[model samples]
Target: MMVDGVVARLRELDGELAPGDGVAVFNGMYLAVTEEVRDRLAGGRFDDPAAVAELDVLFAGRYLAAVAADQAGRRPAACWRPLFTARRQPGVHPVQFALAGISAHVEHDLPLAVVDTCRSRRCPPQQLSADYHRINDVLADLEARVREQLMPGPDPLEAADPLTHLVGCWSLDRARDAAWASAQALWALHRLPPAYAALATALDESVGAVCRRLLTPLVRRRSGGGQDQGGQDQLECSGLPSA
Candidate 1:
């Protein structure tokens, strides 16, 4: 199994991707595997390293195939979707079990992290605890590295905060576009808009700050003029968040 630091870092990086983006899809799979390990650890189902490796391969294969399908513009194959879907049945393929196990694990972990973070009055809604942040940073760095490897773009590490890069791509207008959808879903799932409202407020405030900070730097970096590069260097040397 991957170490906790590695797993946390992966989550941080993957979280930057728009939901359903290919990188996010792969991250989701790995998250599921980590969740399974957490669950077994909790329930006393500890397995040997060989068994863990087998599980990893199974989940990775399913995740990769799903990403490929998504890139090809097809609905995810049934195998790639969450296991609790009505189509799934008992005694399914071993891969199905692995997927199901991992899904449950991730589901549990998210709420736990959110709740823990929320409980810490000092913690920001959008950021995890320091250790968690470190783990997340590692994950974000890894994802950026992978993207650089495959896409060969400018230095993601230097250009902007990956989380901000992600949020900038998802502007307030985009979030507001789905406001109705989000309200309806939250109402149906949680039977409460008050909590959702609070989260929405926090998200709006955070996104607004992110937008202003990211805009000028983003424009400068993309403009690719020598002048912009100089400005960017000045901004960096000033040691202030972009604005």
Candidate 2:
């Protein structure tokens, strides 16, 4: 799909789902990221705008395709399995959900997207490395904003808070670095079909596991009988455990 079409689909999603819904959380962040890339393309931020645009659309398409597959009762990539499975769970925070989506996209889909773009453009992975890193820069900026918007406010034990612990465990910088490595590795395996398949499968599973861990329920204690706005279950409605 074209960039405009992708943006429109995301906007429709943003309007359809609840603001704090797990998928919606990630969708909103992704929408912003895509829009930024679009702006950069128009501003001549990159040496090869066409290549960048192709990579961006292909990257977003992986996400959109996964959503469509999941809705059609087909399983998405292993890396996307976690978000699709836990998106509606009662204990996962919206931020965690968003981070989990980001993890899968960056860690698993990105390397594959790189390969796909190279095939479409008839170029090597190295040719796209600059654009890849440029997209990474955009994602990193959005990551910071997601953290700031979704993270809990300061509290006495905030440093020791479970949510804080969860966020600290996952690093976008590390994911981006790993993606670059994977892209290079895939580039090398391009001529070895069997080896390429093996590595791709391994990458998908490993990234999926990371996403699953990121989405783990981090319930702060509560006294109530139900989940809160962000789908977090709480018994006391605060940090203290249930009486």
C-alpha displacement of 49 in model 1, angstroms? 20
Clashes of each: 3, 7
Cα RMSD for candidates in order: 15.8, 5.8
Give the least accurate 10-residue stretch of model 2, judged by summed lDDT.
Answer: 234-243
| 119 Cα displacement, candidate 1 (Å) | 5.4
Tens digits of lDDT, candidate 1, 89-176: 3212222223232332222222323333333333333332223333333334434433344331444555544423432353222332
- Per-residue CA lDDT of candidate 2, range 1-243, in tens? 777788899999899877657888899999999999989999988978998888888888889998899889999988888888877777677788889999999998888888988989899989987777888889999999999888867543632376777779999999999998998899889889999999999999999888888887765563334455434333221222110
**lDDT of model 2, residue 98:** 89
Name the regions of candidate 2 deviating beyond 4 angstroms. 154-160, 222-243
What is the RMSD, in Å, between candidate 1 and the native fold over all Cα?
15.8
Model 2 CA RMSD to the hidden true structure, in angstroms: 5.8
lDDT of each: 0.37, 0.83
lDDT score of model 1? 0.37
* Model 1: CA > 4 A from native: 1-25, 28-112, 116-128, 152-195, 198-243
